[model samples]
Target chain A: MNAPVPGTPEHFIANAKDRVFFAFDRSDLDESAVKTLMGQTAWLKTYPNTKVTVEGHADERGTREYNLALGERRANAVKQFLKAQGIADARVKVISYGKERPAVIGSNEYAWAQNRRAVTVVAK
Target chain B: MIKVLSRAWGRLGAALFAVALGVAGFSGAARAELRIDITRGNVDPIPIAIPAFGGGDEQSSRVGADLAGVLQADLERSGLFRGIDPRAFIQSFASMQVQPRFPDWQAINAQGLVQGRAEVQADGRLRVEFRLWDVFSTQQLKAQAYVTEPGNWRRIAHIIADAVYERLTGESGYFDTRIVYIAENGPATKRIKRLAIMDQDGANHRFLTDGADLVLTPRFSPSLQEITYMSYYNGVPRVYLYNIDSGKRERLGDFPGMTFAPRFSPDGNRVIMSMARGGSSDIYTMDLRTLERRRLTNTPAIDTSPSYSPDSQRIAFNSDRGGNQQLYVMNADGSGVRRISHGAGLYATPVWSPRGDYIAFTKIAQGRFFIGVMKPDGTGERLLSDGYLVEGPTWAPNGRVLMYFRQTPSDSRGRGGDSYLYSIDLTGYNERRVVTPVQASDPAWSPLIP
Candidate 1:
């Protein structure tokens, strides 16, 4: 692999805020999430060949099984936005980690707000 | 056939063990017998005394003492009995034979008394005999004996406790069962959870998996030494079956999509679970024998956590089809679906009790979580325990108790929080922490060891 190309996964992540947040128990994207997904959409458009994985997550409050389904809905929501914004649906794969992987380690609202997120991961 | 089964159980139970002594009928002419109504609230624990068991020899005598200690602990932990201090004894473990003097036990304010003797048989097997007495009425309530491998002594104690609990409470005993749960450690963001099993009293603890992959929501097979749980192995989420005795692990199937919330039917012949595809999930069942898969729910909304009623004729599952996540029940053939949970908050994780009377579930409402149960018809809803976070209620074999996990909130600095298992009486009292080696969650209680 070449060392540090500008259109590589690391480059894309370094240059963009690649994740969006959701309200508790709600998967619908808000205004702020839409604004961020537009940036992710733009990046995917510029790097047309780059395939990205959208990973969904949830806060620690929901049950494991339900959060999984919830995560799927959230990730699918993000993936749909990217596709609607001129990105190909086939280019974006989605998976849900549910509450298994958290963005932060705390149980408070701030940590929960961060944990309930969907991140865009580019392939190596 | 019965003889063959008992002989087989003789080899399978702990070590070489089987009930050698038949239980005598609880006898008393007096109607004023002592009983613990576990279903009622504001009830006091009955004071009971269990002096160490005695023996003809010193070795057996020591073994008896250990057995008595375990028995007492089991009863006290149920929160239906308060163990009377042995130091306040008017009688000693050695002096008491097959029966204890009621006056001696009554003097210590005991409502129940237990006396037993352990002896090593000529074949080197341990033979134990015990009798439970109603102290107030001065009548024998229960008597039984057992012979088992000397090392399988804790099981002997558990069996005795079960016998006595059934006699006094008019309900089956859960003492002889085991608990399987997810043992978690490491950071919150990257918790390493392993499938672990232990005696119901937290003994004989062992981890089945090495935490090589993330495992969650382990549930026991009601009819076998097997469990079904979800694991993210190779970054692909799938439901898997783990044989406890064989130490074998196998994925349930090559499903079309991600699968989770796996549970065995009451008969253990099938596994019911949820599979998600393209952002939608539905309930399903797989016949373990022929590897046949059946879709039980086909709604666009998320439907998961399918649990079979004791009869296996109906299934209770939680779904988001009715807007909010709520409990719904359907026939085994996937017909006549009806929503059972009409509570204000969203409902998830609906597990049917073994007795076929109630379904247990996790309810999230008003910024908190609760472990609750409701009649299968959705009536008689009762929220048992509430905390910052508590979920995953598994029924004890007897259906008189439920085990669930609770998590405490970490401070803003991400410090000071723990997750562990807890059990409560069916009436919502007697809530006690079930001690585990690590922060444990997603507990599933096994059916009573046959």
Candidate 2:
């Protein structure tokens, strides 16, 4: 809706916060999501004292425990990308909620896709 | 008058002939030994007696009576032990505590005796002491003490039964443990599930959370105190760690996909589960200490329900790699994978024996479910019981028996559905139903107390 947040690939490549990002399903980064991650990385650099906990979650179509591991993988994927973008590895921690926590509560595909996401929350 | 006399003469002649045959039969009986075979006794149950615990006032005495009732019911439901009527007692609780007169107990033929005393401590905690005795030998088999809140009198009774069971059977007792299972309350088409836990005997039952979303497959840790289960809270079925004591839970693993069928490693340090991604499931292990995860399987088949050997060096899991579901075993490091089951039916939920001998599993054949066990090498396959739908075979700590869940057949209208938990010896004897208020499934037996 709003103009995509500003920042380029080079800016994110040099910044530590930009290393962490989210991808859609198995797809790599789309252009708009990458720009949004760049903006988040810049904000993280401004608050150097704060740390982040990246929690990954999945949808309810599969088995419970497997979804948990899958969510963890998604969270770690974000952590690795953030580190590559220039964020110190020490500032980010990752956890997987599996399907324990969901943003949408329904049995449809649309709801599931929205639920299968990784979120960054303040840690300590 | 002449006809009647003739009939009497005929009867007398018959009597004389019987006397001659009786003498011959007596001689044959004297030459042969009298042998009576007792291959079976009353499969009814072994009778036991629990005298009311000594020392409690009007209010606390009521608690004691209720506690003993629960213990009696727990033992009876197993169909292994029968509790003697309290009114049949030859001596009162006070006299038995001071001196359990063996002759009095023998008079009633009480094979086992449970006598105890309860006191309200100054700290407001209930201090209960009990002893289990063998009436025949007048020997004290087990003695233990417990301290808990006054409301936990029922738990104290379970502890005593567990002690008595261990002493008499020479095996660890499961009565003191708790069961975390999926409690279903609604219709078959749209059932509501909430995680529920209670004493193994079904006392002090409580729900962990509201049935806000779908929950399934709740399992207890080895210590029998914590729980790990799958919840569809946010539209995803994931594993969640819940501590029974603290009532706090945290998600496990950090994966890019789904995790399910979680079980604690014997040491309680690692979690072995199945992870699904790209429409395929595989086994994986995550170290609780380091948060490092290693994939255990790479095949493109459905691999789920992973369980660990008691020694933690090997794993037993279920896979459809050979076309249909079957059991497989592999090293902890994911090497040396071998198919173990070649049975006729598709097998699922293979749990390694705690004694490290047999693997308990669920077999489905011809639309009927059966609980069975087999050697690790897939030999000696024995189906313990068959039902409309039977699944989730958890072993007793001794490994000599198993407990599983059975779903009853639908009613005439085909609308009523009911299920309950059951336990049976490996020999297929002593099969009995465990009583519970609501329908329960997916039972997991815990190890005996340390």
Candidate 3:
């Protein structure tokens, strides 16, 4: 298949920076995550046919299993916010990678803060 | 079972070995005792000499050397005995079976001596005979024989070391045990983790699960042949039961919500786990035989990481019901709830020790993590080890040692981040890193195998 053209609405939805971040061990979206999610919702509405997968993640801190549940809560929170902003529930899927997947690769707070995130990826 | 050293002196102790000499027909008494009188809680390791075994054929000779090496490593790692350099040994292996030249050992300042002989029988079984001697007392303290299949040479070595430790310190040995942990690979963002098991000393290492999906927090059952851990097999995190012998996997619960942080009951017949639903987690127990689920704790906060006492009478766990993360204790039925930890930091993973005297916990404060233990009522809390990231403390079967994991910081580029498992004595001394083939975390030590 031919590669999709860059800078399309779908492309913006799939961008890594389109992710909504949360504080440590929390699922509620902060002001920064809310601003990012607004931009994502605007682009997502431009392409009505676009389906997105909301993937939730956690920083490597607490117990492994609890982190997983926390990740799910983050993803669900993101999904609920997106749907309330006019994204259809049918077009959104949610999954949690837990602490298994981090956006940054360090043990410090900076890395952990960056890792606690949820990204809306355009489904292929 | 033999006590040769008097406790009143408190400076030295004896090393005794009780073996199945009846099968080997070695002629002397089945038990031999020697007195050295070393104290139990010495920081400095007692200098000891262990010569290679004699009278083994080519194959047995190789096995014998490996056995001796493993024994030496076990003793040294315990922080109780230091093996002297073989190059300084004046008595040959052949001379060790007979009366050792006490003068030669004394010249090197050796406090104790261990000598053994190995032979492969006509039936293809290997027989190992060992003797412990007190160099200062110039007396043979203990001698015994072990007969087992050739493939089990390492276990035999561990058994020997345990006997020596028990005889000397008047305490049970923890050498003949296994540890299960999460082995990690890949970069920090997308780390791959698999359940791995190995001998206490990192020998016979093997992965129990392929890293197809993420697995973590593996805990051995009271019986050594099975384990309980959390896995995301189908993209839904849940607790699973894995049989070590048959390689079978079974899901513990089909709860609509996530079930994680599972540990076997002290009786090994039920599993105590935390089930998360509706933005809250609660501790629950499920009978293995009947699949009956019992809710032990029902609070709004994240009440997880439940561990049972040795007698299964009380449960110790971590919860946020007290406003912040702290340790709490309640009856097995979730009654008589009381807070145990009032420390300055957030406490997670409160494991009731197997000996029922203390509760091990991980404390996070001021961006640093600490492994500490306290009494059941939360008094006398002493932090054992502190680091950039240290957590997941599990007690050894004997409850004299605690093992946990520590993670070092990685640079902004995500370079140099590594995690290692460590063990420390209950007194907060003799901390040793448990070496694994790769980065490891969440260590769970098994009870001594039957």
Candidate 4:
């Protein structure tokens, strides 16, 4: 895996600021999503010293605690994929946001689709 | 012979119904006497009237009505008051705010009266001022004012209910407390468990974590703010303490094993938990202040679900050391271990009642789950109710009632199982279901607010 240079457009595009989403109530990654995540994995491998945090989130349709666990599963799913793409496991930290911070406000399915997501942020 | 048997069964059913009615009447009188001991004058949930707060325009009148509706619901749910209908008001707030017509309220058998005024301030904040009066005594009980966003009107109503509950019960109220539980979604085989917190009345619901790892058995601190729970984070089951006010958490210990069923001490200075090092689990206590860990029980058998007495002088827990699981009590420092329960069942989750009078426990007998209570000495054992799977008894602040979870069996398809929170009086009369958005379990009640 070739490491992308920091401060490059590729780096910004591959980082967490772009954000990633999941299917409804699912933590598995599809082939296209996996391929896109691999590009970010290459960038993370290039910057060995930089740490990243994965925040898991869920839609507002379920109970608060179960959504928390679902958020955690989503974040862990992303973390596992990143590890498989040549990024060291130690660099990834996961947290479950549950349904607390929803990206959309409505109670409909469209809003929930946006809420069910995980975002990678620079930890250090 | 079959006809004779049918006649005997019919007689038995009629006899049971008569006995039930007689028992109900007797228990009703007993409850009235008990209330006199706990609260003077039979308290009978003082009848009070809340008039629409004056000074609101047509639009603000609607808001006031909404606010009053919320307050009425809160007070009624506490089982502590009868809110008089506003339509029965003979005097308007404009004429009563300065000096209420005591005789008018007295005629309606109202013992207390609440009058208030609401206004939308220039800055868009809602300002509300209210006064509570003892109608019979013609004395003022409480007077206060608050300012908050319009969206927080429900919280303001709860604050008022708390004040009213405190003044009447002579004990702090639980209206301000929050409940943390496992929120469940999806099918039984692949259920997602998340950590969620909400007000006692099921408002302001928020999730603390995503369903990435399994979490269970959340216990609140004495302050009713912090939470300690068992989580399988990092692929290891361990105890973790979280600050509810601030989103910060720390792993409890670095033991090379699994930890589960963590609870805070009465004084909030230590955490008592069950740690499984090998195949056996023992009870351990860790001082949150000193970070010093001590083993409370060193047995080779399972000793789990440890709860500290209110005074922190004794601990009640469940152990299978003596064959089947039974209730046991020990000194706080781990001495004087003694078995308390001699019932005909396996008892798990022995929770010490907050009033220091009884121990609430979950019993598995005859392939059914039952919640029961007994004296600290293990006598006067009484089972409250039976269910398919009922566990985790948490005490109401006054210790007069208990709340627990009941999980119903799934259908033939095995895909529609559900669990809910339920509360029952200690005497086991008022059994009611608490409403939640989804499946809730492992409820822990907080102390009454001061």
Best candidate (score: DockQ): 1
Worst 10 contiguous positions by lDDT, candidate 2 chain B: B15-24
* TM-score for each candidate, following the candidate numbering: 0.94, 0.69, 0.87, 0.67
- Cα lDDT tens digits for candidate 4, B133-204: 777666666766666666656656766777766766666556655678888776653568888887778877
lDDT values of the candidates?
0.87, 0.69, 0.81, 0.72
The lDDT-based order of candidates, best leading, equals: 1, 3, 4, 2
Off by over 4 Å in 2: A1-124, B1-44, B95-97, B121-123, B409-414
DockQ of each: 0.70, 0.06, 0.42, 0.02
For model 4, the superposed segments whose C-alpha errors exceed 4 Å read A1-124, B1-47, B55-63, B106-111, B119-127, B134-153
Candidate 4, CAPRI quality class derived from DockQ? incorrect
Judge candidate 4 at residue B310 and give its lDDT.
90
Q: How far is candidate 2 from the true structure (C-alpha RMSD, Å)?
A: 18.3
Tell me the docking grade of candidate 1: medium
Measured with C-alpha atoms, the lDDT of residue A90 in candidate 2 is 87
Q: Per model, how many backbone clashes are there? A: 0, 36, 9, 18
- Report, for candidate 1, the interface RMSD: 1.3
Candidate 4 chain B lowest-lDDT run of ten: B15-24
Relative to the true structure, candidate 1 has a C-alpha RMSD (angstroms) of 2.7
- Mind giving the per-residue lDDT tens digits that candidate 1 earns over A20-73? 999987889999999999888777778889998889999988988999988988
- Candidate 3 per-residue C-alpha lDDT over A1-124 given as tens digits, one digit per residue, 9 for 90 to 100: 6555664645774553568778877788888888888887887777788887778789877655556667777888888888899999888777767777878877778888888988878766
